[model samples]
Target: MLKFVKGYMESIEGVATYPMISLLIFFVFFVILFWWVFTATKEHIKEVSELPLKED
Candidate 1:
């Protein structure tokens, strides 16, 4: 099964770049998220984190 799937994938043109593009997108998304987490205000983080426990 693995060999058949690998052979089918190898036959497709430009299929190799798909993984690289996916990896690049995955990496960039995390980097942006990391930056956002670090730059966000502590007060805002605390407020948002308590939302679930807060009673309306």
Candidate 2:
């Protein structure tokens, strides 16, 4: 089953770049998220965190 799937994938043209592009997108997304998480304001974080406990 694995061999068959690999063979099918190997037959496709320009398929290898897809994985690299996907990896780059994910890497960039996480980097930005990490920066945002670190730089976020404490007051904003506290407000957002307490949102669930607040009654409408």
Which candidate has the top score in lDDT? Answer: 2
Q: Clashes per prediction?
A: 0, 0
Candidate 1, residues 1-56, lDDT tens digits: the string is 99999999999999989999999999999999999999999999999999999999
lDDT of candidate 2? 0.99
TM-score of every prediction relative to native: 0.92, 0.91
lDDT against the true structure, per candidate, is: 0.98, 0.99
lDDT by residue for model 2 (1-56), tens? 99999999999999999999999999999999999999999999999999999999
